[model samples]
Target: MTHPSTDTATSALPPLIKGPHERRLGVVALVATLGGLLFGYDTGVINGALLPMTQELGLTSITEGVVTSSLLFGAALGAVTIGRLSDAWGRRRTILLLAVLFFVGTINCVSAPSFEVLVIGRVLLGLAVGGASAVVPVFLAELAPYEIRGSLSGRNEVMIVSGQLAAFVVNAIIGNVLGHVDGVWRIMLAVAALPAIALFFGMLRMPESPRWLLSKGRNEDAVRVLSTIRSPERAEAEARDIRATVALEERTTTAGLGEVLRNKWLVRIVVIGIGVAVFQQLTGINSILYYGQVVLAESGFGAQAALIANIAPGIIGVVGAFVALWMMERVNRRTTFITGYALTAICHFLIGFASVSVPTDSAARPYILLILIVAFVGSMQTFLNVATWVLLSEIFPLRIRALGMGISVFCLWVTNALLSLYFPTIIGTFGITGSFFGFAAVNALALVAMIRFLPETRGRTLEAVEEGVTTGAIFTIRSRSRHR
Candidate 1:
């Protein structure tokens, strides 16, 4: 039944194009993931710098929370706006704009003299971070082959952890070496500017998302871009496939917000997307990234040592993401999410237990608490973070991909904002144990929700997954052939 043109197009693909090729895939993913790295650095930089910033800015407990949450609130807004913008402007251009935002935000944060100024800077940075969070994975997913899409898209998560690790290490060094200096936190906050610059300059040379190009009526350009990254044959075939799907979008003018609300299926999918995004953040991962050093200090570690110890969790988070990438090819999305939630919940309980049971003055307290914190990061990054993003990228239909992902990620950032706002108060009142116990309880509930609702989206082509979601034809497939 296949046409000769289809056969020829398929034949032109190189062997690596047909399946997962680590070297080829890794290189491409790494370049695109620099956006994620900058995101991590900007967000994580605050954890170490907050102490100095608070002292210099004369911030109260509430003000501190506000400063931290402002970025997240900005991110929440950015996720929604930029997500739709990426759909209209193309992923690469959207990313380029985000890179510019990062640069401008960094400059603002580094030079800010007042609390209001600092808050403004953080909010701008949050916008860039939020935009990058939504767009990077989608861009990578659009470029990757189906067989390897999970790992390729997950490269952003890996870079995120790596960026966090780098921030922690830099924070420790800067805080220690410049301990005696006035406003030492400025140096720490300023470190983020370099990566933002790099991301902007580097993205100038990157290719546009082939899928986005096709959607925008630039089919020939999409094929040419795909050919460089994919085998010639695979590129042609994918272009044809994308062309086929674009034809469907052409038949429907379903892009309006009102149209999205009117469609039962789109609304259902959007709700699922929002749940996925919010649940991932509600697990309390960012609390640790933003406040781990403070938690460690509460556990009785000295300021200097706690700063160094915080890097351990950052390192573990990155390693866990790499492991997640490996498992992405083998595990179902539902299974991975369930497993992640269970693990983080258990870790939270353990942390809470350690906090309550261990005497504050005991030498063993900080070490034991540190172990629990690392475990929490490990469980989150390995099982939930990468899987959540990958699922978001694949589960929605092409027509509503940007809208759905934006809305979901907006919920995610808002959840993050709420947690960031309340985290210090929770820790201050209940100590580390009570705070973690709270996270554990919330995570347990999230696990049940995921089991009941989250669909397995790994290992399927975007077109196939979109078809499945739109038609309600299939929920889970053990083999690719069944997807067709």
Candidate 2:
């Protein structure tokens, strides 16, 4: 029934870009982001689980801090070590290895009989979390077209906050309905294994990062992998760009910490990365994620009431992430950071004012504090969290991308760990008002840093952006007009 002329014309034309390949890309992103979900759940579960856990484990305040901070300590190490490993072993293989660690770590935590054993399990989980935190964004960034890189890479943060919300919702349900059950906290800790299993299986079918493939001298393989995720024309174009970048790097010295430190431009970028990472933590977002119930209880809510109310911030967190994804596509990264910090600082001041003005026993105090905290979490999720991770993933050149991200995130985890270890003591010594006031001051400084140093990364290819960074054009006033 077909005409020979029609068949020849069709064959001569480029292959029609099908919808299925795009959907496959989405599926790949979703599966890879399950690691983010696990990262959220593992970190946030302890907020509610710790009370029952402490009761069963006979933990003192010091011991409680140990159990809470051990994972963060491990995460710090994991971020650096696993980041370097990813640079060497490839992102897909490292993530597969992390998936295995997630499974083993979850089993260890579920079966832990003593506080020391529990800390060990948490450390293992932290390693997996840290590794995922470092590698997943890079993987997603590499896989995405530069046009949608922010949204694609930022999805990992959404999954992270969603995972946290999942933990909060699960903890509330379990704690309320099964509060009297023996070792109920174990049930909470065990839930992480489900996602771990899903991540392992899902990654088995996923392709290696094409940029990573190109980095290792596998050009044909890189283009072949890219064809699955991108349109044929775009895939070829991207592969050519990546190969050119890799070739340039090969002609120079190898990318590493030593090279990063030796170059002033690279060091400046690394410093900015470190500042972004640290300021994100210094916003005290994790303090809320890890200790929301405690803050609520101190605000005058009963333990049960605090457990239920903690879900409010978690819900807002997920909503804020949605907003962030929208904004990442439309707004400059610098604008997002400034706006987020400004809002969070305002929320902190209001929280402090509400806590100080309202009587400790006043019924209105808890609700007021809760509203402000929700606003703070929303602001943080919207402007800061997703943007920070996305920028960290994008800012560095390919040569030092993994190691730079690792070192920066290593500082982030360390800051988070120190805060987790001391947050309880801080609340005890300063009360909610003084503690929030301190956070306000820190966020004020963060706002200044954002305005002065952070560069816009939207609407540029990874290779183009890296060229700007290496040339220090990104730091100049003229480069703004070019990117704009």
Candidate 3:
């Protein structure tokens, strides 16, 4: 049986028949996404701090890569291990554990006495970042009404970029003021503790996912949880809907990794999911964040100018995310992905050409490249970055949503880690012209993949999307049948 499109599901959200449910859901979503905020701040803060960090830590090029990528590598492990663990333990509880990891990780980084110690601390933070990426969206998606799922899940991306912008602003102030102080980067690193504490404490007031409760055979508890977030009448109805979907999956085969693999269509969609994640990172976006200042400096901006110019991209990223929030619910996912990749590819080429074609000695060259860099940031933020996250959150089957997203993001971070590791060297060898041309090439390929293979996911219910994904039916967008 074919399901209605997401627009139909969204239009069908049980009217705000219950006041308390909506309020509670909003509160819980905000509280849970604190993890996202911390995720953004911790990662973005490093951008401004890396210079002082390198000087104080006495880092070589190899060590610089290690210090930067240790967190990403840790995040890869966190995304995979915690994703599976959350599948069993429960999303809310897993998030709490992640909060603890974030706190400990931040503390370790703040007090590290040596470069090796800092890398360990960063790795710890990576674990928290990875866990947050997987669990928070799962929690949000499970709790949200179908009509608002796009908007609600999209909020996490907003918070993540907001956190990054906050970090960049804070880093600029601290670096400028304490620019002369020893170990000032530690202060920047330590500030992450505030949000970690907030996320941990905030989770105390939140409800366990109603869908998770249903999956574990606690139907009444699911109702209760749903009641806290939806009207009583709608809560009961949604509880039944959720239970039926879970039952369907269970009857098909016990929902597990094995079942997912046994189904050929499920396997195909999973490959697409993994591809989406990898391509998002392969554009070298985070690599820019990880080493933007270095790249900017190499482009002829002085050290202070490079440090300050880094803030421009962070700002653009935040703005682009808000634009994405608006677009996700309105535009076709495939269209947005194609447009985003294509635009970014153009910017990459322009930046590369500007880096080489524009003479370094010419006063306008650095400025032109800077404008191109900002354009690249805008293109990504406005289209690809948040859309990728939104699609990943929405596309997976309920049984493997967290796992699929986790595995996908794991690849993303790993790709990010490798890029972070080798990016400096790549830049060292080919210069900005060569480095950006490589990204352009990757993005050009991604444009084809998106146009040819990616499916539209804008307004479908999770159950509907799951059936489509698991059955390899996404390619066959038949009109909805009256199955229910």
Candidate 4:
């Protein structure tokens, strides 16, 4: 029942305690991540479901690519547009809207009697996924105390991987139990609606992001929300910081996207954000997520085995994310990015090398390739995926945070869409070896990009990061709140 007295509230706050406040924050993060769960299940379900879908719809390779890539293209658009909408409409409201979209999209997908309707449904779901990608991490970052922001924002990422794991398991069970059964894919697709429903109802009870409230000049509301997840002294101090940052930021008020582009520092950060997004996608992770079954079958596994084998990466991905949550609190952001790229690039090359070196009928290529792919996914979840989203959430100023994330993820999905669109063809022409070799080359370039362009945002408050980036002090590799 202790309250932060007026005197201490104006002074520095004490360190955080691990108790009710942390539990409440954890609850909020979990609820918000229901959106992320939908994101993963909707995206990853297609990997196992596509074959059955193709059988029923009589899809050609070209149409299969279209059906798969259409959602990614829609995600690109959704990332940009719905993200912008969140800035205007508020984070909670936008997420609620996305939830409804997820449910409707799932229903559309489940009931689609033809390929065209299914693609339309996939596009609709993509909007929800893309919007969540843009907004959920931001919401978590804003709600969390700066000291633990990395791990808290990272929860959404864990949920994303968990959802993918759920999808893989569900598909394995359904596809195996009802092998080639009519509309088996629809059962897999329909599982997504449950989380969408949870997200809609769960978000209803969550508070608006305090930072967003502060941006709207609702300081009292901001502090109230913060207090629920932080100590009163911490909440008040945090609210004060947010309010000052909001007041100081120009682009958020009078300036628009055009104005932000004109500012070189903002533009630099935005460009870097976009490049990071592209890098994460180009690691060829989604190639495995969306088309793993195809890759495995070609590598020599039977359809049933590939379906089961795909679950391995899903399991490792979730495990890696849990590891990442721990690392996010302890490691430097730039270090993880560099290490992730180096490790993933090496794994990519090994997969390519092993794919070609081993005989096609050796009966070992599938297992070898599977191990390498799982390692690549592990390296990614442990280093890149969580760090990528955390950096995007924290790198930009509050004024342009939404824009930076939206545009960056837009580019990410665009790259993903292109890769998805052409990957079947890539596999057709060049096979697994060539496609992965190409991924290796891309990761090499991405590693260089990370070393040079990525900055350390760990131990920095959002306001501190903004000041460092805008004032060009970021080059000094220091922050205003490093001690915190």
lDDT of 3 by residue, 180-288 (tens): 9998998988888988888889898788999899988998888989888888878886787677778877777554778777878777777888999999898888866
Best by lDDT: 2
Return model 4's CA RMSD, one decimal.
3.9
Q: All predictions: root-mean-square deviation over Cα?
A: 3.4, 6.1, 2.8, 3.9
The sequence of per-residue lDDT tens digits that candidate 2 reaches over residues 1-484 is 2112212322333343666668878888999999999999999999989999999999999999999999899999999999999988999999999999999999998999998899999999999999999999999999987778999999999999999999999999999889999999999989999999999999999999999999999999999998898888768867877787788777764777788778888999999999999999999999899988889999989888999999999999999999999988798888889899999899999999999998987878888889899999999999999999999999998999998899999999999999999999999999999999999999999999988888878866787777768778778743453355
TM-score of each: 0.93, 0.95, 0.95, 0.95
Task: List candidate 3 segments past 4 Å from native.
Answer: 1-13, 16-18, 478-484
Model 4: number of clashes?
A: 0
Cα RMSD for predicted model 1 = 3.4
Q: Candidate 3 at residue 379, lDDT? A: 92
Ranking by TM-score: 2, 4, 3, 1
**Model 1: per-residue Cα lDDT at residue 248:** 76
Worst 10 residues of 4 by lDDT: 1-10
- Indicate the worst ten consecutive residues by lDDT in candidate 3: 475-484
Error of 2 at 472 (Å): 0.6
User: Candidate 2: which pairs clash?
Assistant: none
**Per-structure clash totals for the candidates:** 4, 0, 4, 0
In order, what lDDT does every prediction score?
A: 0.84, 0.90, 0.83, 0.87
What would you estimate as the lDDT of candidate 3?
A: 0.83
